[model samples]
Target: MWGEMLGAAIGGVVAVAAAPVVLSAVGFTGSGIAAASIAAKMMSAAAVANGGGVAAGSLVATLQSIGVLGLSTSTNIILGSVGAAIGAAGASEVS
Candidate 1:
């Protein structure tokens, strides 16, 4: 249990630190989604799915918002929780 907890804490921290960098690498940036990039492709798909516009709470829109304004506290917490769950699972497997 302790091992899992430690792993979870570390994983959460790492995920929080890495999320923005990862998002940026995939073409999600402060300015906007980059053309000819993965982000653009995702947006295009989302727009098509929503009949010519990305839905307000769609994945692409949420990601773009994160890219521009960064994760909100709730979203940060959710990400950390997911990371924690994965880390705990990994730790348990190792043990």
Candidate 2:
């Protein structure tokens, strides 16, 4: 249980941290690019987290027992995207 939580948290943090770099790699730049990058990173993180959960032997049970995590993942994606968009806009403004 604790392991799953830890893994998810780590994954989320990693995704957030890596968003900018990943976006930049994909040719994302300027103000709004940051938001897009963050979104992409979050989506990547969720996919990774889901894979990890399956590997940890809790995928099915986790889904059955607690569905909120899935919702949280969706929320994370949306929020991340918004953030990236904002960043891109900011970057454009600066440029």
Candidate 3:
């Protein structure tokens, strides 16, 4: 139980801190989605689905927004929660 909590805490922090790097790795950057990247591919798909335009509030758009503007407080909280859940699950499994 203690180990699980500890893992959860660590995972949450790590996930929050690494979000930017991970986003960048996947081609989401401040300068917009990188060419030939997964982000680009997603954008293309989204545009095709939405009649050649990525709709506002869509996943692709939201991600790009985050990439450009950085994560919001609520977003950080959500990320941390997800990370905590994953960490707790992993720690529980290990124990």
Using TM-score as the measure, the top candidate is 3
Candidate 2 Cα misplacement greater than 4 A, ranges: 31-95
lDDT tens per residue, model 2, 1-38:
44444444555555555654554554344332234554
Ranking under TM-score, best-scoring first?
A: 3, 1, 2
RMSD of each: 2.0, 17.2, 1.6
Backbone clashes in model 1, listed as residue pairs: none
What TM-score does each of the candidates earn? 0.80, 0.32, 0.85
Better of 1 and 3 by TM-score: 3
Q: What local lDDT score does residue 74 receive in model 2, on the 0 to 100 scale?
A: 67
Q: If both were scored by lDDT, which would come out higher, candidate 1 or candidate 3?
A: 3
lDDT of 3 at 62: 93
User: Across residues 17-73, which tens digit of lDDT does each residue of candidate 1 receive?
Assistant: 889999999999999999999999999998888899999988998999999999889
**Lowest lDDT block of 10, candidate 1:** 9-18
Model 1 lDDT, residue 11, Cα? 81
Off by over 4 Å in 3: none
lDDT of 3 by residue, 1-95 (tens): 99999989998999999999999999999999999999999999999999999999999999999899999999899999999999999999999
**lDDT (0 to 1) per candidate:** 0.91, 0.47, 0.96
* Count: clashes, candidate 3: 0
Local error of candidate 3 at 58, Å? Answer: 1.2
Better structure of 1 and 2 per lDDT: 1
